[model samples]
Each structure stands twice: as C-alpha cells, then as structure tokens.
Target: MRLLCLDLEVEDKGGFFAYPSDFVELDCSHKPINQISTIVGSSNGLLCLTHRYRNDSQYQYLYVLWNPSIHKAIFLPVPDFRLNSNRHYALSHGFGYDPTTDDYKLVRVVYVDGTVPPQVEMYTLRSGGWGYLTASGPANVIADWTLSVFMNGVVHWLAQTPNGEGNIRNVIVVFDIGHEEFDEMPVPKSLEGMEHLNMEVAVFHGLLALVPCNGNEWELEGEESYSIWVMREYEVVESWTKRFDIDVGVGLRRVVGFTKNGEVLVIKGGKLLSYEPSSQEIFNPHIRSRTESFYFSTYVESLVLLNVEDGE
Candidate 1:
C-alpha cells in the first residue's frame, strides 16, 4: 500500500509524505491550509481533496483536483447550498473518472441531521462547475462512517433501509459515472439482517469486495476477525461468496483499506500492518504514528489534470 503520510506533530509544519523507500514531500504550499483535510478519491493519477475551515460562524468547504506528479491543481468553486449554523449537516463524497466522456466527476451528498433526504450534486472537471442531480441519493440512510469506494466506474457505499417491521437493514448504494444514475445492490444474505455488523466496501481482483469487520467495536480484545465477501458477478445478488476469514489476534484498533496486491492493511498497536490473504501472515511495515487514527487510500502516480487550466 502506497501511503500518503500526514504529520500531526504540533511542533512542525503539517505536511504529507508519500511513503515506502522514497520520502518525497508532495507540495501543498500553494494552499492556505497546506494540508489536505480529506482525500475523497483518486483515479487515473488525479486526486480529489476537500478542505474545510470555519469562517466566522459557519464552516466552508473547498474541493480541489490535484495531480502531484506535475504539481498542478484546480480549486473548484463552492456549491449552491446554504450552511445554517444551527442545523447539523454531514457531507459524503466520491470521485472517479469517466472514460466515455474523458471527464473526472466528483459526487457530493449532503444529509441534514438524518431528517431530510440527501441532496446530491455532481461536479465535472471539464465543465468546472457543480450541478444538482435528479437522483437525491439512496432512499435509505447512509452509514455515518462508511467511505465511498470507486470500482468499475461506479461509486459504492453502505447504507441502511427500512424493512417490513420498520427495522433498518444494511444495503449497498451504487452510482454510475457514465449514466449518472443511482441504483441499489444487495449485500450477502448472511449480512442483510445483520444491521449492526461493521462493514466496509473494497475492490478485489476486479470485483466488488465487502468486508465484515467482526469485533471491531463490539467484541472483546483478541477476538477480532475480518470476513471478506466478493461479488463475482456485477449487480448479481447470488454471486456473493465468502473469500477469507482472517483472525487478527490482538490490539486491533481498526481495519484500514486493502492494498493493490490484495493484501489487507490493518492497524495494530499504533503501527501499520499488512496481512497477506494467501499466506495468512502478518507483516509489519514499521509505520508508527502518534495520531490516534489514519486516513489512507491506494495511490498511483499519474499526469492527470496536468494539462487542465489551474483555476487558482
């Protein structure tokens, strides 16, 4: 897993380091924050970042399209949404590239305190603007901590929908970049009724992989395990298969994402560890951090957005 390491030490200037062998510092000196608040997603060597800051009474968010390889970036304009200080708001985003149109699109979903339907918008890099989409988002509740994963030109998220008894159940919400439409996919039957299960989405071997992180939050120490479910066929309910069940012994604070080579990246004892599914062996890369949590994604260096106009 290529890491984008952020230094959280107060004594030094906060910056990012692309890790493993080469300690190269990707420049963010052009922006005021000089640090990326959130990495939404990356595709074709282009990264989508969000920066949030408070302005007097309310928080303002700025979206950026950056290509570190060429050190070029474009800051997108703010959306047409009102931010009332009294009302609570949660924002979720997904970024991907559309090969059909040769465009990079960023999706934003705004949920207001779980009372109103989510407002969905799409921002295309070529057009350089945000447009409200007809799809208001899934007719279900998106899990608060679920991160969006882009695979096969569709963005996926874990959501909750009400069942017959007015009970909430877990489901998958997907949005196509080409069609610009939203659709629903089914989780494994074993996981459908398990609404309390801590689940996450990932891509494995060119297929959608759903990981159920057992005992991540609700289980006792030394009993945490991860079960991977891979959808062999796209959009097919029955193709879900149980791939691996890894028992990570102890001190597992959280399950990070997966590596490009199919190794699972996990956190144990404030250090980064990689677990190879085939060998079932745990290897520590010796990445230690003082920060309590980490934000990471699989990355590749590319020249995307290098030729685009830099709207600074």
Candidate 2:
C-alpha cells in the first residue's frame, strides 16, 4: 500500500478545522512539491469542509482528493449558508462515495442549541448544494456530537436516546443515498459504557464493528486496558464478538484501521503497530515522526487503504 504524508498547520483550538485554510495534501506516488489544500475536514475521507471567512460572511470550502496520483486539489465554490458558524458546533459529520451514480456525498450535523434534538444538514458533491434532513425526534436527541461510519453507499450515525436526566442509550441511524432514506438499527448490548468513553462505529471484514473507549479506567491499566468488539455478521445482533484485546504496556492505544489482508493496524502511544488477527502477531513498523513535540491526542487523523486493488 502507498502512504502519503502532508504537513498541515492547524489552528491551536480543539476539533477539526474546515477545509482550504487548515489542510495540506501531498502526492506520495510521485516526488513533487505540489501540495493541495484539502477541501474537507481532516477527520474523515468523504466529507467536504467549509469555514467562516474571517473578513467576510461567506464560507470558504474545499473537498478531499481520493486519488494519490493527482497531486492537484479541486476547489468547489458553492453558495454559502448560515450553517457555517463556529468550528466546535460545526462538524464534517458523515461522508460516502456511491459507485452506482459515481457521486460523493458530504454531510454535516449542525448542533444549534447545546441541548435537545440536534439539527442535521447535508451537502452533496454531485449537486454542489446544501440541504436539510428531517430529524426523527426532537433536535435535542443527537447533541452537538459527531459519530458516523460509511459503508455500502451510505453513512451511519449513532443516535442517542435520553433515559432520564443524564442517562442516555446509543442507537444506530443509517442514511442510504441510493434510496435517500434514513433508518435506525438497535445497538448491541455489550457495547454500553459510561459517558466519557466515546464509542465509534466502523466496518471491518465486511461486518459492523464498534470501538469503545475504556473511559476513566482505560488509561488506568495503560495500553492493555482497551478492547474492540467486532460483529462477524451484519444486521445480526448476536454475531458480536470480542475480536481483540490490546495491551497498553506494549503501546497499543486503539485499533485505527484494518488492512486488506485482514490484519489490524493499531496506534500505541505515538507509534503504529500492525497486528495479524489470525496469528495474533504484531509488527512494529516504526514510522519516524518529524514533529519535535508530538502529543498523542493531536495525532488523530484518518487512515485509508492506499494500495488495495479495486473489486478485491
């Protein structure tokens, strides 16, 4: 697989910065100094990003380039909306590429108020327009948080159901582009946790996977303390299994992404480790970092399969 590295100068404030201003793209296949400014959020691959211009009310926008060979970045100029507000309330929420129509869709979940049902807005790459999605319950249910996973020409988000005052249960909400529908799926019971442990949903081995943070006790035991659950079968609730248990002592913080060969790529401390699931063997591909003061939390970035062949 090919790896491309881009040197980005991000704002010191927390969360992802909108595209054009906060991103830099590098072409790894060819030795060129040409770096394109990314048009989407740095967290996910599919979402396009928009930032409020300091001088003007208009929002500056950009999109991510999936092609490694094309070092040039495409800047899409679209109509502005009031949704381009603060960076914290604004998120590059959900994204996905549809093969049937050969179109890419970018969605942003805008949390207007700090409480109640959350407001969601969508932007399509094909149409170069922004619109709104009909929320199921009150706007306060989703909160001002972003939780999304893309699979099969659709993006899935985690929905929250408040029990009483501060108690809440998480559910899965899926957006299908082909049919243009939003559906809900029940979350597995084993994945429940406290509020601090932010859970993430992912697709591994063509099956749904949930990665939960250990919260208060996660770092207490160090790297060995964290565990990831993988669902072997999709749309089946009982197919869940504790696929991997990480040892924080060895520097395993969490599983970032899975390789095409079914191996898991893990991030431990500031290092990257590749683990073969079947053999349970871990390989430390020590990727040297150029940054002098590297913080574990600041290293958060998206990982994608670079060299995997199509239709594999």
Candidate closest to the true structure, highest lDDT: 1
TM-scores vs. true structure, each candidate:
0.83, 0.63
* Backbone clashes counted, model 1: 0
Residues 1-312 of candidate 1: C-alpha lDDT, one tens digit per residue: 355654323222334545434344444566433333556778876777777778778777888887766777788878877677887777778899999999999998888877536888899988878899985666767664567789989999877773444766778888899999888899888778664756667776678887644334445322112577889999888999988876567555555666666677766666767788888899876776532334555567787876777554
TM-score of 2: 0.63
lDDT of 2 by residue, 55-150 (tens): 255344343333323222233444244544443343335666666766666666554434444455565556656667664423224432334567
lDDT at position 286, candidate 1: 73
Q: Show pairs that collide, candidate 1.
A: none
**Model 2 stretches with alpha carbons more than 4 Å out:** 1-66, 78-80, 83-92, 134-147, 162-166, 212-225, 250-253, 276-281, 288-312
Error of 2 at 96 (Å): 1.4
